[model samples]
Target chain A: MKKFINQADDFIPEMLAGIYLAHPDALRCVNDDPHCLARVGATPGKVAIVTGGGSGHLPLFLGYVGEGMLDGCAVGDVFQSPSPEQILAVTQAVDTGAGVLYLYGNYNGDIFNFDMAAEMAEMESDIRTRTVVAADDSAGAAPSGEGNASARRGVAGIFFVYKCAGAAAANGGCLDTVARVAQKAGDRVRTLGVALSPCIVPRIGKPGFQIGDDEMEIGMGIHGESGIRRGPTLPARQIADEMMSWLLADSPCQSGDEVAVLINGLGATPLEELYLMYRHVHHTLSQSGIRVFRVWVGEFATAMEMAGMSISLMPVDEELKALLAREANTPMFRQFSA
Target chain B: MKKFINQADDFIPEMLAGIYLAHPDALRCVNDDPHCLARVGATPGKVAIVTGGGSGHLPLFLGYVGEGMLDGCAVGDVFQSPSPEQILAVTQAVDTGAGVLYLYGNYNGDIFNFDMAAEMAEMESDIRTRTVVAADDSAGAAPSGEGNASARRGVAGIFFVYKCAGAAAANGGCLDTVARVAQKAGDRVRTLGVALSPCIVPRIGKPGFQIGDDEMEIGMGIHGESGIRRGPTLPARQIADEMMSWLLADSPCQSGDEVAVLINGLGATPLEELYLMYRHVHHTLSQSGIRVFRVWVGEFATAMEMAGMSISLMPVDEELKALLAREANTPMFRQFSA
Candidate 1:
């Protein structure tokens, strides 16, 4: 797998340099550390939102930093967690008198780092902070009541968490409310992905896993973690139907429920194919009497250049719908509405 | 080479079904022909802009149909031109009292079809029409003084033409003015692309072209058209510099000129890699003493799931800048400004 990179060690910094250069008007680094990136215009009195994780997932952690979204991000190298110091720096930089909320995925390293950063922020800056780790990958955990939900790996559904929590904060919610909103969204949204091909980490220089040419791994994690099963490649409709069924089985959505559908390309899948999956998902939802109120069909979260996609559904209520409709202006993602 | 598709013949219709299902509010079909997609709300007196070409390039022709962009699009099968009847239907559906403009890529099949469609519109519907073919792929033609510019392929730079022409039409420009703006934009923009891997057409189920594991092809077209040359892949910085220099040598841009840059992913390249390329592009532009006015880096136009990217530069005067900054609200693209 040939990559457009100079050196393995420079991948993250160079990518960060490129991001800062391309979006100077909207994003900035703290203390010249490219890993500690924050939005340019921070509202001082509003609660700040900060997210962090590995770097392979574009538009996930860093891309969410902007108006009506997150205020800062602590970026790590490909599939590696950021240092506690880096997280602390970002937290301190974005924190206002109103406090900061730490929102990120449910990864052990990220959890450990953010927890340490929160402690450091409290001790050193005297700032109050809250944490909400998204655990939305239905494949990684038992159904809602069967097992621990907090253990699931976060995936594309994390976008909803950011949107809901960010909207709450932008609407002048207190730190507790923002955290509560984030947690609520995280708990409600469910995602499951299928992998047609694996992706290579820049430093690794090879694919993390392999799939047969005529096979796909269903319910795979973004990092190429083992899925529920690997089987012969299926048609787009069948894939969507199976994924949607799994998601529905794990989620709280029932007849007459409304959902926000997100058909996210994992990395290398074409937008056309994602739309095909969306078509079938919509069909299944309508048959189940589930109404799709809003839809986002593109690469919202990606795993480098992996060839596959993930389907995420967030059953939305009046509050979630309003929050999801709120305006968010970021480099990779944007939404405009009430 | 696996694809997320059903029967090969159903590829286009299924994808169109997905698009229609997902965005019924913003787009609709003409006479129930899935190939003839148009914006739902057509301003009665506004000069309508219509574009069409082969399918597989999402957000190119169909994705541009909406407010402040294009009024309608005649979609086709993968890498195949739409029929003249399809184009005629779109033109008649979108054309109000104001005349319509035919804006599309400069391809042999497309030219023949659209020209036929224009003739039909004049003879049957009595709708006035003009044409502007985008020939912005600098790699496909000689520099300004050397050869006929109409022979070049229209790549991702067509986005600029759409923005300028669409803005002109939205701002109440007559058919002639919209056509003039489209022609002006088509003339000023230049693009060059590199392909790292071949893409498989759905019916073919095999790559149209192939490259070595560690090689890349520069100056490739969107539909597997042979590129200028193939060679071992270089670092991102070197690639950016080389591509930028080629564009500069062939373009009208000179020192102190302001330009908008678009670093577009072919399909499979990751966003992180695109930024690395963007970072070096900014450096190269700065070194050339050219001013960067605006930048858009993403998958604007794609070639299925081909792996690589392209860079586009458009020198802008006050007129072009204002037109480029105007608001556009399409399904895949939205610009809110000016």
Candidate 2:
């Protein structure tokens, strides 16, 4: 049970304080609330894109706050949803003259908390709010996307959703348009992850289950959600092939379809291994004649020190491609569209 | 010895293969030498910047090559220097009509190999080259910078040096000017690192050194170089305060001086913790009345999976500040000045 933390209870506040110190030019905490952060001077006339969820997943929820991305984020403790009060504070802090667009993963805690905040915003303050759930973990849904994507857990593909929606909002697109594009990107993007190790929540302990040295679980979620199966550890290429099989099964990415590929390292997985995994993913996608519009490989979202990786693909139409290519820079996640 | 690598012997090549796959847009292997990678189509008339060092420190030597950054990087085995031949290949691959500039940490192996490569380039290929040795680790040298800073080890401060020199060269500075800026940057930056946990090199085990559970080493190098001393573990703020004391003692940053701060995580440390460390660093600098021109918090350099962090500060004159604020984007590090 070795870890690097001060008082386990002081984790969230100390971490938020650190973010503010490091990114003063781009970010700031809201009204002395460490858990609620907003971009420095979000565009006054644009739709405010706000999101929140658990902590522990670096570059997610918080890291995407900046121009061309989120306007504000409500941060929770590790893997725990932000309280409704935290969400409401962030929602009020970043709302410009325009209404607010809420973006977050489709977890139950997040849904409940955000729903509560949205109701409060409507009743208490005359603010209009909309939400587009990011349920992009395709394997968490049915083998096919008939109706199960609604039930699937959200994972790293939320980055893509944020980018698409944020860019549209930054360009003065209305809240409905931003939400529509976000929903489209969220619907098109499919993700599948595999874990070779389990991690702990410092406040809690190690995840309840154990994984052996030679074993791995496919379709693992960031918070150690139940995967479909567990078996002997496969090589990088096989892992890519197996994940791609499920990814393609849920949503058929046909020949000539363009996609943006993201190979996200889940915590302890090395960047080198993630790229090795990407090599196979690229080859497999090419074999199926799917055109790679672009590729992103790095630690985008993580679960503490879980030694695993997730491959997410967002099939792009013209509008999605243009939005994905827009410029954005936060502390952790960044892209230069030019 | 839990690591996410495939074959033990194929480590370097496989890792490079993954890098190429993930970053074909920014980098390409030179002369089919997996150990040598160069930015694709470097500016044809600008003085080229090239660097190399051991592998395992991902996003370091190789990941820094792209627009407004290094033109090339020669890679080595995990924590081992690349061959002189590999170095020469990268030097020649990125050489524009303008001469080449070599940049690297002041490691023994790196100095020897890069020196040999520069000699070969001059003698055989008629290419002129200059070198900048970054020796920024304050604790790795004598207590004072009067004469001993020349012998200090290079760690995360090397990133600042690269940013300064690369931006200078990208601004069309001549080879000599670029070399001058790089040397000035190398001299002005000071860094101090502490390791709470030691990491292993996959080939061999933990370099035959052990620190007790309650103990930590201050001023540890990336290769676990001998630090100033060992003592009981401290909290994050205290670690920042202690490291700042050594950093300021070596290179006094007076009030009204502006500086760039980087809180680098040695592998296995979480970003949340790194940000927390930056919080204390910013507070200490503010107390000193030193302005933070910029702040970078994340893994710039690492000893694979070592649970510790280092703080680097470079007193930025007007020139160094502009160079740092210049735009740059490789796979891992990026900033847009707009």
Which consecutive 10 residues in model 1 chain A have the weakest lDDT in total?
A141-150
lDDT of 1 by residue, B68-123 (tens): 89999999899999999999999999999799999999899999999999999999
**Candidate 1's error at A232, in angstroms?**
1.3
Misplaced by over 4 Å in model 1 are A142-146, B142-147
Q: Score candidate 1 by DockQ.
A: 0.78
What TM-score describes the B chain of model 1?
A: 0.98
Per-residue lDDT tens digits for candidate 2, residues B159-222, read 9999999999999999999999999999889999998878777678444368887888898888
- Fraction of native contacts in model 2? 0.42
| CAPRI class assigned to model 2 | medium
Model 2 clashing-pair count:
0
Give the alpha carbon lDDT tens digit for every residue of A155-220 in model 2.
Answer: 999999999999999889998899899999988888888888887787875564689978998888
Residue B239 C-alpha lDDT in model 2: 71
List chain A TM-scores, every candidate, in order. 0.97, 0.97
